[model samples]
Target: MSDTESRLGMPSGAGAWDERSERWLAEGAAGTAGRAGEAASGAEVPRAVPRRGAVDPVKALMHRHRELCERAVDPLEIAAGLEAHGVTDRTAARFRHRDVFSLAEEMFARVPRDGDSQGFPSASPSASASASVGREWGWALWALLPGALCAAAVAGLRLTEGQTRLLVAAAGVLAVGLGLRLALARGPLSRHGAPSAARPATGVWIGWLLGYAALGDGLLRTAATGGPDTLPTGAPDGPWPLATAPLLALALSCAPAAWSARLLAGRARRRLTSSRGLEEFASAVRPLLLGSFALYLGALAALLALCAAVLDEPAGYAPTLALGALLLLARLLTAHGFTHAPAVVLTACASGEAIALAGVFAGRLPGCGFLSVPAEELLDAWGAGSVPALICAAGALTLLIHAGRTLTRASAHAHPTPSP
Candidate 1:
């Protein structure tokens, strides 16, 4: 055996097979084909070898395929590669499936815990994994940058212009697109064949894009009516003064969060042993829930603090509070399914409707706006027309339950044993 093969745990004579077994397989195969083809063709037709893509089948067997499959390399592909490269394995031919699998088991065992060798197992698994991790973190920062800027814009710069808000959202979209491309191009996440079907199809993406565009247009139209720096009268004029700025920042932020989740989930799926994968995933749910809560609360508190400092009007505090609360709820809830379209639509629509209802009440409250009214009057009015309040309460409770369950799972993972 070659030093490389021995190191890979490949048997000393994997290429050897019993002469009798080889003859038997060859004879049997020809006869079987001959019998099967008798009704269609007078003689057996020769098989055509496939050398799909640019890589030679021989070289692919030597290297790349192992990387593609990770440690779970396929035995049949090995058998075919051997046949295509004119190396014979009597054990592989006679057993057809068994011997190749036996070889795969040995090769998989020989595979270095960290990819180190060039032939039997991938030479770059560790490097590829490290690269993937680096890219994920880099993309996370890509997501963080825009969100931080948007939050700052809302708090200090005063995000009042519709076009500027669109531009921010566009930058987020661009980052998400670039990160996704980088993830798919090299190492760790790829498949030997086509992409995984678990992700949404192109049509689904198109539909989502169309829906988001329509939502953006409606928001733009709403802002246009106000004609910049003006309010819809009684609507909160502080903290996201244009009313749609929070929504725009939120919509933009979803791309990064979703991208990160998709990458993390995919990594977990690809890397973890099936036995412990679900358990680990459940553990992660709590951290995600906590992070989402922290993000919402932190952003709201910071923005509210800035509004108090910058606006310098006590009256400005109330509207800012109302706006901040609604946006916070929407952001926290929608984050649960940010990686998926259907979930995004459902969470967004539900939260958006609830917040819009609050806006409606504000627009039509007696004497003064609902948000502008005193707390006692607002509570009394809520008591008088309590159906909407009930709906909002139910939705909020549902989301709370989800968050609580996620936290529980996280806590379970964190404290697997009781304290003494």
Candidate 2:
């Protein structure tokens, strides 16, 4: 096996993740077709029609390469896998230098001329008639989209301010509906297993946006301290949202939120590449994160509702927002791609939170003022917002290290081998 395979093992017995990850980047993950764009669309190879009754020459050629991807870390390993997969000794000798991506490009270029070869039924007369009708309907819809949008905007401009706002909102809804229709029209990306990386991650900050917009103005209004003893950097009282910096910070920090959740919550699975242990562990922990997040949200909502019922004003502004930030930051941490056991990473997160909370209490760390709304003129306790800030600090450090390692490997792949 390749020397890099050993790096898949961690400094300790984190299992063989080091070897797994090394294999992942070296030639892409096993049993994974690269992204659709990278596969058929991106390749610059010649597209040639297959001969009648002929084998898919390209697919036949790639069979051994895919088989070798399982346990082949080095030339010797690949040769062994190739032989075991029924490649003649002469054939194996000729393929010793073949790169995986090059082989895939060739496979992409091969177009099976018959429907049976590509596993599609031949078009019947009725099916052909329906396809033509569908084509006409598509062109008609395409022609109507822009005109409808212009009419909506024109109608909105002639309405009263309040009515205009409603009209604009309706138009926005229509636009989203149109976008969804177009995306669905594109069909699925691929037929077989798409590698984990092939899946696109959406941002989950929309929920945060809705929550912040609904309560933000009140949250900031309640947090303003008139006391002279207040720190110079503390949030000043105003109708406008508190410090704009936190908004930007949260936006960037939570950009990866959805992606992380997908990884932790078992949304993405590396079927061919990752070990069974890693997969099972990920599958198990995902539910814990999901259930934890759900329970936290339910409790937070109920607490806020209770506060509203008891107090006349925005009562849960401080603790509710603080805890909400903590929940999101914690979810983000779970997606941090720990190489070893999930337990070790979870431990680090818990310890880091404790240490960070201590630092904040001692005035060693800056506060997340935007999220830390105050119940009174002053807060005597370190607000729970410190948990998220501290968690973010730790996650940022680890992510930086991961990025550096990735860059180093890319440099090696570009030139020679990287340093271990």
Candidate 3:
């Protein structure tokens, strides 16, 4: 049957469609088949209406900018996508040209409620520590240069001045440098750097004196016995122990001083916690008190023992021994005072120097039997001559201690609120 007849009608005894209806149906079917084929090929698919400039130009620029940003930012994208509509090209570029950190923050802020796509990155601890240590070392080196130069000058002078003057100057410079370094390291009294204030200055001073005595003794012995090159200094039988006896006596005298300092340290810590300004002044002095007592005890015992041991020698040596002990004590006390109790340390220091001068005067007195010179007369003469000196020393110490205290109070008043 023709296509039109098949579509139109069915014949009797064998089904057939009418020709006109079949032709109309065939045309409709052909049209549908053409459309279906076009749809399958995407030619007849519906197109989404394009809104004029709907895609942000800033976002396009940022995407392009990543080519540069990617080189710098390894694991993270530095530039962020711009979403605002009316921003100028320049403004948008500036916003996109931020660091990875800024970009990350911007992205985080923009993507509110987005899971796991926002927040600041973790800091690199190792890198940060390295940077901090590097900076600290740089500053430390700069500060140390002056002290190092002073030390070098003193050390180099030994050949020119003979050992005595050179040694004295070197020791003085060393002590001063140490004091300065310690002060700087501690910082202003308002902000001391050390954690353990419980360590009394008095105790520290005693220890320092003992140690210094040992060292000085060893050096003197080395010089006296043989050239330092051939000497075995580290041996226990070394000159240090022998030299340290007088220092030990002085130290023993200062034993009670250390305990007193410990008490002072406790008080200071309490005051400091309350944001008191006098923390440093009090802390510095408290230690000195304890150290003074210790020094006194150590020095007395060491000196007496030494005197007994060397009794066979001329009795005059007793006074000389006393003089030497006084000198070491004076020096150690001077250093400690400068560090922690500038006034008291200085007064103690001056007294020691006076004692040394008296010994010198006695030694030089014409026809004055050096040992025969009564100890009392010697002391009286020194007191009479050194009266003004003693007064000046005492006054200076008093002023320093007083000023330090006043300054602390003033600081406390200035910063009423404690720093976090």
Best prediction by TM-score: 1
lDDT-better candidate, 1 vs 2: 1
Q: How close is candidate 1 to the true structure, as a TM-score?
A: 0.34
Cα lDDT listed for each candidate: 0.38, 0.35, 0.36
TM-score of 3: 0.25
lDDT of 1 at 251: 34
* CA-only RMSD, every prediction: 16.0, 20.1, 29.8
Local accuracy of candidate 2 as per-residue lDDT tens digits, 1-420: 323332221122322333433443344323234433456776754343442113333334533243323222323333223332344434423433243223322333432222332223467899889986885465345433433443344335334344555467457446634532342232121111111121111212323332342334334333333222433221224233223222222322222333333333232222212212222323444454455445544544554554344322333344344434453533333223222322333345445444433333334225644333332212335443433334434544453344333211211111111222
Q: List where candidate 3 sits over 4 angstroms from the true fold.
A: 1-184, 187-341, 344-348, 354-363, 367-420
TM-score of each: 0.34, 0.25, 0.25
Give the poorly placed runs of model 2, Cα more than 4 Å off: 1-94, 102-116, 123-205, 210-222, 225-420
- Deviating ranges (above 4 Å) for candidate 1: 1-130, 148-300, 311-420
Error of 3 at 274 (Å): 7.8
